[model samples]
Structures are given as C-alpha cells and as structure tokens.
Target: MVTVNIGTLHNVLDHVYGAFMHRTKISPLFFSGGWGGSKLELLERMIKQLFPEVVGQNCPPTLVKPVWNTVWETKTACLREGVFRTPCDEQLLSALPPECHNARVAFLTPKFVPPQRMACVVHLAGTGDHTFERRLRLGGPLLKENIATMVLESPFYGQRRPMMQFGSKLLCVSDLLLLGRATIEEARGLLHWLDSEEGFGKTGVCGLSMGGVHAAMVGSLHPTPVATLPFLSPHSAVVAFCEGILQHATAWEALREDLAAQKAAMTLEEVRERMRNVLSLTDVTRFPIPKNPDAVIFVAATDDGYIPKHSVMELQKAWPGSEVRWVTGGHVSSFLLHNGEFRRAIVDGLNRLEWKESPS
Candidate 1:
C-alpha cells in the first residue's frame, strides 16, 4: 500500500484554490440593470438612511413568532426558531427584486430564564440548502451555555428561498445583493426588537462564513451595544466570490458564461469592478466601527482558502482593539479542528462582557 504525503496533499489543494480564483469570471448583469452608478449610489444612500446611528434606534421592531421544533429538543433548553416578516421601506422594496421584497427572517432561540443576556448569532450556511446540522453545530454550544442563541436565516435561504428556485442557488448577482440588503435590514430590526423587550440583557451577533460577513456588517451598522464575532468570513464580497472557494462552484461558472455571452460589450474587469461596488455596501470597512471594539472577536483560519488572509486582516485593521483567534486548517476542516476552542472563546468572551457590565 502506498502512503500519501499529507503536506503534499495540502499543497495540491492550495494550488487548486489559486487556480479557481484566477479562472473565475464575473457577469455584466451584476453591473447593469438597477445596479449602475445611480442605482448603486441610491442603494448605499438607503443603507445609510436605515442605519443612521450606530444603534438602530430608527428601525421599527418586528413581531417574532416562535415555532417549536420538537425534533431538536434538548435538556438544557427548549428548541424553537422564531420567524418574522422582515419589514422594509417601500422605496427600498421597490429597488430590490420582487422575490426579496417579502423575505422573512428566521432565528433559533433557546428557551431559558428569559436569557439574562442573548447572543444572537446569525449562523449563515454555505452555498446549499439550509441544514439543521450546521445550525446545531454552530449554535449548540451557546444554547447549552444559556446564552440565548439566535441564528438568522440569511435572505434567499431556508423559508425565504424563492419557490421557483428549488435550491439555494442565486441565479443572478442582483439576487445576492438583495439578499445582503434584506439580511442587513432584518438584523437591524431584530436588534431593535431585542432592545425593546423588557429585561433582555446584552445581545451579541456572530456568524460563520457568509453569515460572518453579514454579522460584521450588522455589527458595524447597528448602533446597539452588541458583541460582534465574525468567523471564517472575508472583509469584502469581492474577495469572497472572486478569490474564495465559491469560485469553483458550478453555479458561479454558469452565471458567468451566461452574463459573458449576453453582455459581450463589457469586459470582465468592468463587471468585476461594478460587482465590487455593489458588494461594498456590505463591506465591513465601509461602515462605522463597533461601539465597543474590544467586544468584536474575529475567528480566522490560517489555511482557509475560502477567505483569504488579507481580507480577514483588513477587517482586523479596520476595527482597532478587536481580538482574533487563528485556527489551523482550511475552510471546512478548520471548523471541525477548532470548533471546541472556538466555542470556548465565544462563551468566555460573552461571559466576560456580562461580568464587566455587572454593577460593581
């Protein structure tokens, strides 16, 4: 039997990741149609208007309905996911795709002592159908700790995914931007709801991969006092789609080819630039720093090909005084390799915050 060299295998995988990034293409449609200079400017303006303050005092509270899932019952806490219709301004809705207009936000909240403090972790799933496995794996530890864990279903995912689209594939870049906008807005609403509730303690937001990116944006935009923890996420959407593991996905390639053939007049670089601008709305650096920079924790993987090291560093630099914990493995493997340590860090971080804020 021949033995495989683990080091060599890792190097090969790294090389493949590099190739995927270089070979990936962007679509002109991402730049055109309601995403031009004026439209993009309008989008940015709208986001700024919605989150005028660091704390989302302007956003209206949304009514959340908790739906019990008996299948996920645990001794520590009652398992239930809350659903709410994401409220959006009429102008914002008109600008986004019709499918995203009526999108909803779903979150898994552990029932306990009214949660002295709640850590609303937005557990974003990768490019696929939303799975309970990911939710439990990422949010379970927090629930066990009695830290009311709430996982927000990213827009165009779970119940929000369009009926015609039988999977998590977003056919157009427009849809992805709409998803970003909806999730950001919905998260603001949730934060407001948490703050409005009597006796609800501090609320923190954390996310993994795509969800991490959303958490970063939400943390920066929401003015409320929240601990922001973004794990396995890049600073910019451009890096995520252009240089991340998502470049290898078949859906992206198909969309690229379709856009290439349809918009031959536009060059790849032009399309890329436009897409980057659209995604910049959610870019962590574009927004304000968190109210408490020290409360922001970033979990990064040294060997993560899905999120380039530079992107993670960008976010770190953007938020001075923020802490980072490095794991040793690629995107997927790092989750399993450092899950225990990551969970410990989260629990400890949030607990420390709670203690520090307690009356002396």
Candidate 2:
C-alpha cells in the first residue's frame, strides 16, 4: 500500500472536484493552526497544488487595501472565497500593512465550483507567536532577509494608548471571565460572517494543538458547523494536562507542579468542586457533546506526549458515534505523515451527501 500519501493521485482531486460540483451550496475549506506554529504552510502548499490557479492568481500588494490588511483580507478571502488575486493594485497595496501583504484569499467562480456539495472547513492556528503581525510577515521566501525587521517592538509607556490596545481589553475580558465562551462567540461571529458574505450555509472546523481545542469547543457548541475535525485537542483535557504530562515540559511545568502540590493538600472532591467551574473545557463526557452534523477526530498518538490516547478516547466517548482517525506519530507529526489523507478525509467528508454517514 502507498502509506506515504493518504489522498494521492488525480483520483483524489477528481473526487474533490466532483463533490463541489454536485452541491448548490458552497462549502469552502478552513484550516486552523494550534499555538501559532501549526504547519500552515504545508496546508497552503497542498491547497495551491490542488488549485493550480491559486498561485497563478497571487496578487502583489496593490489591489487589496493596506498591504498588511491586504494579507489578512486575502487570507480570509482565500479561506472563505476560494480565489486569490494577482496583478494587485499599487496604491491600494501600499496602503496595506506589511503583515497583510502575503496572506491569501480565494473565490468560487462558475468555472472553479466543483460537482459534489462541499462544507466549509476552517483551520484555526493556536496561541503561540503572540504577535499576529509577526505571523503575517513570516511566510514566503522573500521574508528570509527581513524577518527580524518586521517585528513590532514594544516600548511600554506606563499609560495606555487607546488605538494600540484596540483588542487588548476585549481579549483580557474574554480570557478573564468568558472561560472559553468568548472563543465560542467569536467562532459563531466568524461562521455567520462567512455565511452572509460568502453564501455558504454550513461550515466545518479543524484545528491543531491550541487551535484544535478551540475548534472542538466551538464545534460542540455551534450547529452551523455540521462537521468538525479537532485534529489534536480536547478543551477540558487541561485537568489531565496539569496533573500528568505537564511535569516534564518547560512552559507549563511550574504551573503543573503547583497544581499537583495544591491537589495533595486538598481532597479530590474539593478540588473538583473548586476547579469544575474553570476547567470545563475537557469534560465533554459530562456536558452534552453536540454531534457535528458529522463529527470526525484525527489524533497523532505515537509519540504525542501532550495529547494522550486516553484523553482522545475519553473525548471520543463523550462524542459517542463520532469517527476517530488515529495516526502513528506525536501531536502535529502525524499531520506531516498523513497530511494528504487528512486533507482527503476533510474534503470527502465535506462533500458527502448524507450527514448520517459522517466519520463514524
């Protein structure tokens, strides 16, 4: 068997093409990366390969808006629209922020639309790389020389700068109180925006690492996304994260140790009672796991210390009857190993006619 590539050959493309053509409703694919460092380039590369016109249509910084905004808009358009712009406008391009220059977007024309019906797939990148501007400029071969120059260096002047901190307060508010509720709200806003703007009714979500957890939570909460692929995440898994695997890691190791010590002092019941309000992201089994119109899970189990099989299985049980696609490596490693297959499953699942037959 050709284990290297899960969805290979022209046949895969043909299947995808068929899926899009059959349906009247448009379902563009969305890719979410976990913790900012997710392998987004790989996903983009595959998309470009499948859609040759994508790169050919790549617009230079002009036609879009401020270059940075252009990149952001373009990327959004690519995910929601299904077309990229080439021969971009100069004035419009110069106005765009640097971060927006390289982001991509696409649209579905009569020519580009496929035969089989498709569902929207949104890939969410996780919480690393704290700087969105930096993430924007990091891609493409040209950035090799100017990577460091693009950094938005900080100079704290005790007081606040209203515009500079535009989203800062909202973020803090969401983090401090919402307990993942804000993320769910944001995801809903995004889905509705896409539906209204792009004419796509149904949406599906896929995320890795942090993005995975975000996707899973939103998938479980919303009905708009009939299908969801939480590539490597479980929201409530943090209890396990803090108690078990976090010991050896550097970033969250201290917090984990503190939790362990605290747990030793308190009764398990007391601990659960106190933390239950905050750590509800994981216990999908406890809460009702909303079945995606069709829900599918992909986990990288081999060397994945961060996300254990037990966690995945536990989440799986919560989402009983859902389909789980297990791979051989660690967290995102399996994505690299079986990216093609994963991609196919996504496209195939989205293209599928009946929701009853989803992944399970």
Candidate 3:
C-alpha cells in the first residue's frame, strides 16, 4: 500500500480550487488593467518613508472621530458600525478613486470591561473580504476571553469597490499597493483611538493573507507595543504574484503591453521581473521589527499552495523572538479549519505584552 501525505493532498486541493476560482476562462481576472501609470510612482515615494528610523514620526493623524451610525447590544457584547474619511495626504487622496476615499469599520466589545482589563484587536481584510461578517465571526468566540474585535472594509472591496472593477480582481498592480498603504494608515488610527480615546488596556492588530501583510506593517510602525499577529501571510507580495499560485491569476500580457506603450516594451519574462521589482516594496523584512518583538506571533500552514513555508519562516527569522505555530493543512483548508489556532495565537501574542500602567 502506498502512503499518502495529507498536507500534500490539501495543497493540491488548494491549487485546484484556486485555478477554478481565478484561472477559469469566463472570469475577468485580477490586475487586468496592468501597472498603473503616474499613480504608482506617487505611492512608491510615500511608502519609501517606512524605514525603521523615521516611520513613527512620519505618520500623523489620518482620521477624525468616526461617526457610529449603528449600535446594538448582543447578549454578551456591544456592536457599533461607523464610517470615516481616509486621512491619507493630498497626493494619495488625489490618486485614490473617489469611491475608496471613505472607510468603514465594525467594532464589537464585551459588556463587562474594567478600565485596565480590556484588550482590543483590529482585524484587517484579506483578499475578497468585502464585509466584516467573517472576521466578526472569528472574533465572536474571543469575546468570552475579554477581547474586542474591529474589522475595517479595505479599499476596492465591499461597498468601496470601484464600479468598473470585478469582484476581488483589483484593476491594476499599483492598486494593490494603494490598498495596503491606505489600510495601514486607517488601522493605525483606529488602534490609537481605541487606546487614547477609548482607554483600552491593550491593543493588537491581526489579519489573514493580504491583510496579514498590512497588519504586520501597521504593528511595526506603531509607537507603543502591540500584539502583531499575521496569519497565513508571506514575507512579501513577491511570493504571491511571482512565485505562488497567484502568478496564474495575474494579467501578464496586459502588463507587457502597458510597459511597451509607456516607456519600453518588455518580454513576458522581463514583465515578470518588473512585477518582482514592484512587489519587493512590500517585503515586511525591510521594515523594522515591532517595538515589542516578543509580542509577534505567526500562524502558518504545513502545506500551503498560495504561501510557501519559506515565506513564513523568512519573516520569523527576520524578526527574532517571534513565534511560529504550524497547523496541519494546506492554505485553503487551514483557513477554513484553523480558526481555533488563529484565536490562540491572538491571545498568546496579546498575553506576551505588559499592559500600559494606567498612564501613571
């Protein structure tokens, strides 16, 4: 009898699902609009400011008070839905499509909370996550553990999606960078509001897939200690667009055509290399380790079709003192099967941090 590797089998399943979902003939694919022209350069200049020495200083207030338009009480918690204008600088605001200018969030808090005993974790959006429902459900069980959950609607997703773009297929390569940058700014602001205004005892940021990458960036730039949890994320976008299952989903011909018309034509291989160069800007290792490195925890799959083991290990290696726990499944299966492990990581990471002493 031949032995079968369960993890490998799961990986195969993920690829099959991915191809059917993204690579099929009828679907209008992602990155179809190609590399954005002038819009991309502006974003690049802004993102370059994220080095270890100056990031904290550069980020300023990006949100006014969010108006909570909806509020209701659950049996054990309170829920609020609110909207706020994205606080990006003028250049970014000009570049962003009007539909994506405003941001939306859902907040859930436990009813019984003492001033210094509560913890809140902001959950960022992953690919195709158009609403707060999935994340809210993930954080629902954690409420018994006394942790509140906040979920943000990513730009170009949910109601914010551009009318011309298809579901989950971001129009251009630059659009991805724009989404990450905007999410970081908004998430940082929300965490600050929770701490300084709402007086939360401890705060953290967590996300899965693409949102996981953005969550890591936000946590790294935060001035104080925050539990930084990135679940099923790669070290860089390069791993996804250049080396993983997403390569098939990309619009290579469109990218080549755009480059050719703009400045110079490029071979398909050259276009791939260009994609690598652009996505390299998203490498998390390039950013500084979090203020509290020990508070970082990574949850990875044993066999992930979309993210390789090396991608997860690289970030852990770069940020020493960070912990990595492996769940026994591939990318898709792990996402569906491992909410418990993810919650455990969130609790464990938050526990590693010492609470701010009641502001002395």
Most accurate candidate by lDDT: 3
The residue-by-residue lDDT of candidate 1 on 1-360, one tens digit each, is 999865445435755754553434532212222333344556666655534353345454453433334445565565555545556667667655555554433445566555444555445444443654565666676665656655566666666666655455565655666677777777766776666653446676777777778878777777655778788788877786666655544244344454566566555566556566656656677667877788888998777767878889999998898888887667766655677766765675565455323432
Q: Would you list the rank order by lDDT, best first?
A: 3, 1, 2
> What is each predicted model's overall lDDT from 0 to 1?
0.62, 0.39, 0.89
What ranking emerges by TM-score with the best candidate at the front? 3, 1, 2
- 66-134: candidate 3 lDDT, tens digit per residue: 889557896778999999999787888888889999999999888867746888999999898899999
Tell me the alpha-carbon RMSD of every candidate. 5.1, 17.8, 1.7
How do the residues 91-115 of candidate 2 rate in per-residue lDDT, one tens digit apiece?
Answer: 3234222332232322211223221
Alpha-carbon TM-score of each model against the true structure: 0.77, 0.49, 0.97
Candidate with top TM-score is 3
The 10-residue segment with the lowest total lDDT in model 2: 149-158
Q: What value does the lDDT take at residue 222 in candidate 2?
A: 53
Q: Give per-residue lDDT, candidate 1, residue 95.
A: 58
